[model samples]
Target: MTFDHYGIGHGFDRPGFGEAYFQAQGISAIHVMGRGDDWYQYADMDAAMATVRAATEGAVRVVTYGSSMGGYGALRFADAAGATDALALSPQYSLDPKVAAHERRWSQDFRRIRWRPDSNGPISCSARAVVVYDPIGPDRWHGERIAQDIACHLIRLPYTAHPVTTYLSDAGLLGPLIAGLLDGDFDPQAFRREARRNRSANGIYLGELAASQPRRRVATALSLARRALDVSPGNWHAQVSLARLLSQEGRHDEALSILAVLVQQSDRSLTYVVDLGNAFLHAGLTTEARAIADEVLSRAGDVAHLHAWAAHICWLNGDVADARRLIRRAVTLDAGNRVYLRAIIDYHFGAPYIAGVRGVRVTSWLRLARWMMKAPLRPEPAEAVRRPFPFRRRQDDSASDSAG
Candidate 1:
């Protein structure tokens, strides 16, 4: 059985993570999906477990596997489903503020979850467990916590960072490694050698590594980005990295040239659009930035971040009234976003970047500052910005379906 990661889906009928790959191999598998970013902490979780248990009954050997949030789910339900082995890739030990307070990456989702006792508790399993994570990444803390809870083998992929599975997959190691692990013939030394050899060809790894380079080593970063593009031309992330680096070097035309194609090819992806808009703004092309905002807003409504982006563009273009209106809309959509709130306060009372404004309404500004201090530092959910789950069915669809 496999469980899905965070933001993978809100419903089923669409394939769960690894569903297609397992199906193509003629392997019997069941997928446990969660609604929204709930982290499988559904109100009917016990019932969902019952379904999984019933489906796995009399199985010769059961293995639960998943990555990230899915990884957590695999370990969480291993004992309940009578699994012999649980394989988790970049799994969390807990998302509860009290249990894993140091985990700030997924705070937005954490706040949304009404944590039950079982939801974010330590893993307790008789099953043989293996956890894969980047020791240098935030997931190291999570992997360590899982180790503290139970006896489990920890596979540390140093510098691979969070979503280590993506790195492995990009390096053409995931399928083979997973197969070897499941079949009990996995060799860590061999895997590491292959990964090391393939790392240069992995676009995600290359781009991230490039982005992580210090300012003084920007030449090296640019070289790495170009190498990423050279090896993986279709990788938009690599392209974006290259573009951003060019922009950093004041190569505006070159940056715009790269982003222009990306923005066109991305089917108006808000993320890419925002990047392009920011690139324009950075290049002192306010007219182009305004045009991009206008085109996006004409079609893209109900998204907090889009409004925020548009508001920012408008503010820089000296349209304070529209900026204020748009920013307020953004705050209304996502009250917890500190960035949007800060922008609101900045727009009304003038920030450091905006010039020629006397400190007007000092008392109101103080009140807003106090409110900002109390606000949760949460990013707006992707669901709020994009139609992530196009085939969102009934909430109970996964629970009701018979396991494969």
Candidate 2:
């Protein structure tokens, strides 16, 4: 069986998820879709388990699979439905308020949800759990927490933050890893090899890595982005990173060139589209950026991140009224999504919610301190993952994302 993860809002373009991938491998799959409250509040999990059993009826065996929010559900369902094993990618330990008080990323979402069990019980499921996550990423706290009390084997890959599947899939590792686990032949070394094989070409990884470098090493950061483009010339976000860095260094022409080629490309990745719009605006290509933003907002998809991007573009175009409308729309679509909330905070608090303050160098000790305070954040390269403007001037009330 398979379950889908929690995106801030649905990616309407995505037709299928795990079930589709598994089906391609000749494995029959049952899918569990989480909508609205995302199972924590709306799903009658027990009834769904009964349905799975009734549907599978006398099957020789079963295993559960999911990533992120879906991963949490997979383990929760595996324990309830008596699945023999579970494959969870970046699973959270629990959403029970008391247990997850220290978890900051999705706090507001937890508060409004109809959290069922007060106490987060241990993973007492008979099934052996296989979890893959980045130890330094957002999933670390929960991943580590689950490993502490369960019959589980941990596969820690730090190259990708939060949803390792995004990075894993980029390396063509997810399908094989899941297949191997299902066949009871998972080879950790093989998995590691697969992850490393195309590391250089993983533009998202490279872009993230470059953004994490010290501010004083802007040249080094530019080189990392250059390396990223060398291996994957079509990485739009990497191009945007490169352009942003060049712009910071006062090389406007070169920056505009990188973004010009990027905006002309045919890549359809959401972040690519979003970052392209950012690059266009940064290059003083307002009409072009506004066109893309308008097109994104006009689409039927309700993805919060995309809406957030569109909102940013509107703000950039000085359409404050339209920006307000778009940001409000984003909040309505996914109030739990912090990016949207951050936009609201930026508007209300007059702070650089997206770009953050100038030169806020998060020291190593600060990272450790945050780790002790709550979950350890994938600090470096993370902020740069989305924020791309380290040298940006605080003009009027806006800042841009270069990394995380």
Candidate 3:
């Protein structure tokens, strides 16, 4: 359900964004329009709460979603009426003091109003609350701080220009939002998988100490990475780095096991697929590598670099015709890419600009290099790098030596 205050005055009278989302998800929707001058008045709270209560009386669950000013109203209403869950996007806790001052100076009736959680009364709802916002926006951050103080689940979407509801009109955002709403549906396992994937793409940092001497501080770095994974098992960087370290230590089986789970969970990620395929190839699991390469190519056919990678796999299997076709398609799609262009010249025409560049080896190397370049950069894993260690400190380290 949703409430609209900002929508009414602007002649943008339509069902609220939440209402539309609910409808799209094959759920019933109720949109309550705000009436009267200055909808921010607290007097409207009771009426709104009453309306929500009446509408969702016998329902199994009731979720409240709101954005902008309506988001503020929704939070107040959810606290009062007792909703199953509340999702507020880009809400404002209160107008800026300067803005309030400006209004007060301009109008005699404009009194400074602030969001008083105490005045709204104690919240009785045990709803799994989620507040989505861009941290960079001051007005949005005000609401985010309130959500944080209340121990609400905060989903910060950095670099977003505005509220998620406005930015994510492309339907993909609904997947996560819907998944969040389902009872007992929180997937710690999925989070762990994502965390691992992210770490693999972006190098994780444990801390200043560990980062200062990465190889020399293996034990501490591993400990820190483990701790980060424990805190949020779904952190990709923690998982990836853990796996990478394991791989570096000749624990290829363990590394592959960690990456396998991530690959299974993240089928759509081209980078994940590529990484998994590479891991399999390194393990000498030819069948698995080929299967993964094929799956990635099928899903990412339009991606020129992915196609080129698949062509390399075909070439490895001695399917010259298929390899040639894929490389041709890749060259057509990305004409300016020197990597693809060079591959075509070396492989198809047997022409090498560089010295000692045999057609067969050059084609193979360029294909593999192109695939590596296509893997998406994962930044979330970098957070794990900040920790440097994932385990409890030994007594000796605290008392005796600063050096590991």
Q: What is the TM-score of each candidate against the true structure?
A: 0.78, 0.70, 0.39
Residues 157-203, candidate 3: write the lDDT tens digits: 54333444543333235457645564546454453344334432222
The ten-residue window of minimal lDDT in model 2 covers 395-404
Arrange candidates by TM-score, highest first: which order?
1, 2, 3
lDDT of each: 0.78, 0.68, 0.56
Ranking by lDDT: 1, 2, 3
Residue 31 in candidate 1, Cα distance off native in Å: 1.1
Please say which candidate is ahead in TM-score: 1 or 3. 1
For candidate 1, list the clashing residue pairs, or say none. none
lDDT of 1 at 329: 74
lDDT (tens digit, per residue) of candidate 2 on 13-101: 45444655666678877877666435444547678778887877776667888888878877877866667779888888887767777
* Each candidate: RMSD: 10.4, 12.1, 21.7
Model 3, backbone clash pairs (residues 3+ apart or across chains), number = 24
Model 2 alpha-carbon miss at residue 69, Å: 2.2
